[model samples]
Target chain A: MTTTARPIRRRSAFMRNAFPYFMLAPAVIFLLGITLYPGIYALYRSTMTGKFKLEFVGLQNYRELIVDSTFWESLYNTLLVGSLTLAIEFVIAMTMAALVYRDPWVKAWRIVFLLPMLLMPSAVSYIWKLLFNDGRIISDLLGKLGSTLGNIDFMSSTSLARMVLVITDVWQWTPFLFIIFVAGLQGMDKEVEEAARLDGATWPKIFFNISLPLLRPVIAIALVLRGVDILTMFTPVHVITQGSPAGHTETVSYFIYRTAFKSFEQGYASAASVLVLIATIILSQTLVRRFFRSGTEA
Target chain B: MNAIRKLTLSLWAIICALPIIWFASIALRPHNEIIAPQPIYFPTFTTETWAKIFAEWPIMNYFKNSLLAVSGSVFICLLLGIPAAYALARYKFKGREDIGFYILSTKMMAPAAVAIPMFVLFGHFHLLDTVWALMLAYAAMNMSIVVWIIRSYMMEIPHEIEDAARTDGASDLRILWSIIIPMCMPGIITAAVIAAIFAMNEYLFTLIIASQHAYPLSVALANFSGGSDGIIYNAIALVAFMAFFPVLLLVILIQNHLSRGLTMGAVKG
Candidate 1:
């Protein structure tokens, strides 16, 4: 009886251990079917170059991508817009987070603040496109602010168009960073901050030293997530600028999109897509690593 | 110092609210007034734009399509995400952490990166220009978020409750249905709401996959900007307002869950 029970017990343990994979099967299979398979297929398609008839060109598409000035320009634009937006968003969100962390009334106003983030991106882009019109509210407001802005087309000028894209992004996304920062601030150990204050640490010192370090994980996560998103920003550019004025506002994602759909260069677009995937992976891995390290330390 | 801070915050709030307020005003104004050079910060009210949106545009069809896509995506997320979240939360398994990271890493890949491939795949399967394609794409896009959010919530529930249920001869599914799910209702709801909002707002994949047949409000509103009548600002505003209103209301109602949801529980309020 004891010998028979022992085998049964071992078999039951095996079944119990296998239960998790059973539970995980559906999600894994679904994601594999949808995301992973398609991604791998894209990578495979990137090597071949042809519209209708396929020809395997070893590294040819990638070589062309390297020499492609337009691709490089879009890449540069993506980075510039992404970094500028991040810097502005971080500063504003951090300041606002600091201001609102303790005030009950202000904390309650988070919902209002988050309104922009909540709206559909396309809708936000559409609304901003209208506002950026030559004689619209935004232009009039700028004129009122003592600038020689006489019917300036915001989207036609390359510099102004880029600035407008950054501003619109900052407007829509700062609230998200603000919410995260506020949450990070609230989640901090009050004792450490109060102790620092009692120890004659100035507010700025406490912020720079204690609060910032403590909030590193949240900030890092926000930066990476927002960075990835900003890099892929499409709707605003597509709707407002359409990558016009000599394609100055064209982002990497938008360029890839136009290449794939508009120009129908599936092979080259796939090559670009593979490069994007690689960049995303490298950046996400580094950022997520930093986030995890800080998270564990905190 | 406190007073100065308060003043600054109030000023910032006004700045933040300005565009939205302007948007609402534009949406309500007469078309001629919208194009008037003298910026109408506050407009005399009119509903002609809204009236035209309903009567002339296929706004309702857009709304219905948006509803179907969002609901289908959310349903898929919940159906698949819940079990995976449960396993991650409860059971210790080989490659558990790796699997979790893999799921999250999938999100880092932008939808555009896979757009061409997905387009081809859907086209091959004759799924293009269908809401089902949009639903499936969105479901794939949002599944990671659902798992992450719901798993975080499930982790917060004590394991002893499940242990007790197991001792009482309840199967894992039974405990999940009877005990675990009931306890994690708020988390599930938050996950579902976030997924729905994402699906509703999804533009790129929808734009690529479904042109006219499955065009949601996002595509419709985008198309309005390039309409033949040449940029009726008020009508565009009205359509934008209509497209945004439902999600805005939902966000306000569930504002508590939203902050945490948006961050995927990275920062808890």
Candidate 2:
């Protein structure tokens, strides 16, 4: 009985050891097929040209992107719009989080705030389009206010078009930062605040000197995540403006979509995508590494 | 201070609620009223636009496609993510940290990079323009989120319970099924809900690959526009509301877990 049990026990131990790997195998394989394979294929495709019969182009696509003024314009627009959206979202979300943090009467209002973020972004873009279109809600409201905003075409001017993009993004995404900031605020050590209060720190002083400093990690993580997402803003650009005013408001994602799907310039699009991928990885890696380090420490 | 606080709170609340209220109002208003030179604040509400849109477009077909593709992806995400999450939570193994970071990094990848090759590959395999294509794309897109959220939840469960089950000679699979899963039901549900919301809202991949038969609500809504009569604001609103309503409901249901969902489990609310 002992000898028979030993062999079965050995087999079971092996199975136990292999269990984790067995569980992880499917996800790993699936992710590789979807992410890694495509990523490597994009790299290979970036160096080639032609539709049906492919021919090698070496660095020609990259060279073309370097010279393409529209490519540069799209890149600039992405960064400009990205920064504007992040700045507005951070300010509004932070204010709302600060005001309502731990307030009993206002606690229920959090759900309402989250509604905007939960709306489909595509739908949000359309809603904004309806609001900002010529002779629409925004123009009507502006006209009521006795301003010339009613006559101005928001989608025709580059700055105004970008503003519409930024507004749509902020309306949809501010709640993401709001909820995270609220969570961070709640997760803070109450004792530290109590100690600060006991030491006669004013509310502003406490917020600036104590709370803001302590919330740095959460802020960094939130901003990094939001920034990365904003880098790929496409739907608003597509649905609201279609990069109107001569592609002045075109984002990199939409530009890539047009290049690949519209023009069938697969190789050129792949090159642009690779550049975007590199930028994304570098941006996320530094911030994510710090986050994980702090996470493990906590 | 209390008056000031109330004032600030209500102001922000109005800011948040007004757009959604107006959107629903638009969906129920007459077409001429919606696109009038002056915005009609108190137009007579009607469902004629909704009726018109339903008649003109295969709105239900698109709705069904969205439901099928999103639900299919959510099912796949959980099927693979749960076991992978369990492994990450319970085991300390070689390359564990590296593998975990890789998964998280994939979540950050731009959709464009993958979209190009995926479009080509799907066409190559004759899988383009199908719900199955959307399912596979969305599953890959959201796998990281499902894994991370579930893993974070799994970590919250104490290890002693699992150790006891192990001592009783329960197999790992049996323990996970009978012990861990039932305990982790809330996490599982949250992951599924969040995954569904993201999958349902996904536009780029679906737009690039799905044409006629596979157009989810997102694509269909984007393509829906004013024909010769000018921009049809009311009909667009109806379709937009339809696209978002289901996820909006799911989001409300998982309110407590939302920060975790949005941040891919980086912050717990």
Candidate 3:
């Protein structure tokens, strides 16, 4: 009887150990099959040449990517667009967040503020495309401003086209950052802030030294998430610019789309994709870790 | 200070609403007014544009496709994500942290990184140009978000209730179904709503993996811009309005949960 009871106990313990894996199985299997497998397959295909007859080119695609002027330009454009969007979005979001944090009426207005972010990216692009039309209100206003400088076609000129892309991105994403910062502000310890005020600390001093430090983790999370998104921006460029004016407005993701679809250079596109994947992984991992660590210490 | 705050807030609100208001105005204006040399700030209202959009384009077909794809993908995400979320929330499992991080890392991988290979794979499986391919791709893309959001909510549920149920001889699946699910229903709904929105908005994968047969509103609206006649402002505006309205309704309905939903429980107020 004692031996039998011991064996049954051991069996129950084993089942308990196995239960979590059973629960986790479906998600893990689906992710691995759909996402990870395709990524690995893309890496493998990147080293090959030719589409139906397929021969292993062994890094030839990468070699071309190294000296590819178009690729370089697209990369530069991606960084430029990404950084500008990040900067503009951050400043506006922070200012708006500071103004409206804990204000009841403004709090009620958040729903309206989030409309652009909530709309489909494709839809956002379409809206902006119309606004950027030569005779549209936005273009008319900018045109008036441009007469002082020079002629301006928002979608045709290289610099203005890029600026339009950045503006559209900022309009859509600022509310995302604003909402996060507002939440961060609401979550702060009011006692500490009040104490600082009682101790004669000025508003700027308290904000720069206290509130900002406490909000670092939230800020970090927002930056990394939005950065990844801005880097992969495709819809606006695809809809509004289509890399017009000699590919000046082409983002890296749009460049990949053109290569694979228009040019039918699947191998070269795959090579570029692998490079993108590496860069994204490295950037996210490093930034998240670095910010999270500093946030905790602060 | 109060006056300044009100002015600033009002100004920002106008900036925020300007594009959407402008787009809607174009959709309502007559065709001639849309193409005039001067900008039409206010034009006579007409439904001609909307009538033309519905009459000429397969707008209903695209809407149906989008609805089916978004609902299908959200259902799949919940089906797979709930159990995994429950496991991470309740159970003490080895490799739990690693698994959570892995799921999140999948979200960081840009869709373009795998779009070419997915196109090739779909070609082999004959899944290209079908709603099934879009549904599957979106389900995989959104599964992590479902897990993260639901898991955070599930963690807030008291453990003793589950323990009490177990002591009454309830199985793990039985407890999850009978006890845990009803309590966590709100979280599940939030996750589903957010996932649905994301799936509806997806463009890159849909553009690459689907042709006309499974084209969603996003793709259809995009193609409208590139049509042979080229860039009719009113037509594009009508299509854009139609595309944005459903999402606008959803966001307003769930405004209270919008920030929490978007952040995936990261920055809760």
Question: What's the TM-score of every candidate structure?
Answer: 0.93, 0.95, 0.93
Across residues A6-65, which tens digit of lDDT does each residue of candidate 2 receive? 232234667767888899999989999887788789999999999778899899999999
- lDDT values, one for every candidate: 0.82, 0.85, 0.81
Model 2 TM-score is 0.95
Give the C-alpha miss distance for residue B22 in model 2, angstroms: 0.8
Instruction: Please give, for every candidate in the order listed, the TM-score of chain B alone compared with the true chain B.
Output: 0.93, 0.95, 0.95
**lDDT by residue for model 1 (B1-269), tens:** 88999888888788777778877787788776766657666678888567776787787887788889889999999999999988888877788877877777777877888899889989999999898999999999999889988887888888788887776667888899999899999899989988888888888898998788788877777666455656666666666677677777777766777667876766676
Give per-residue lDDT, candidate 3, residue A148.
Answer: 51
User: Candidate 2, B218: how far from true, in Å?
Assistant: 1.4
- For model 1 the TM-score comes to 0.93
Model 3, B1-269: lDDT tens digits are: 87998788888889888878877787788777876678777799998677776788787888888888999999999999999988887887678766766776677778888899788888889999988999998998899889877887788789899887776667898889998889988788888888988898899999998787998877877666455545666766676666677777776666666566666666666
Number of clashing residue pairs, candidate 1 = 0
For B1-269, candidate 2 gives per-residue lDDT tens digits of 76887788788888888999988898888778877766778989887567677888898998899999999999999999999988888887777777777878788888977899899889989999999999999999999889988888888888899888776667778888998889988788899998898888898999998988999888887666656767666766777788667777787788888777777777878
Off by over 4 Å in 3: A1-11, A134-136, A143-151, A287-298, B226-228
**Model 2 misplaced regions, further than 4 Å:** A1-14, A293-298
Q: Which number leads on DockQ?
A: 2
Worst 10 residues of 1 chain B by lDDT: B222-231
When sorted by lDDT, best at the front, the candidate numbers are 2, 1, 3
The per-candidate count of clashes, in order, stands at 0, 0, 0
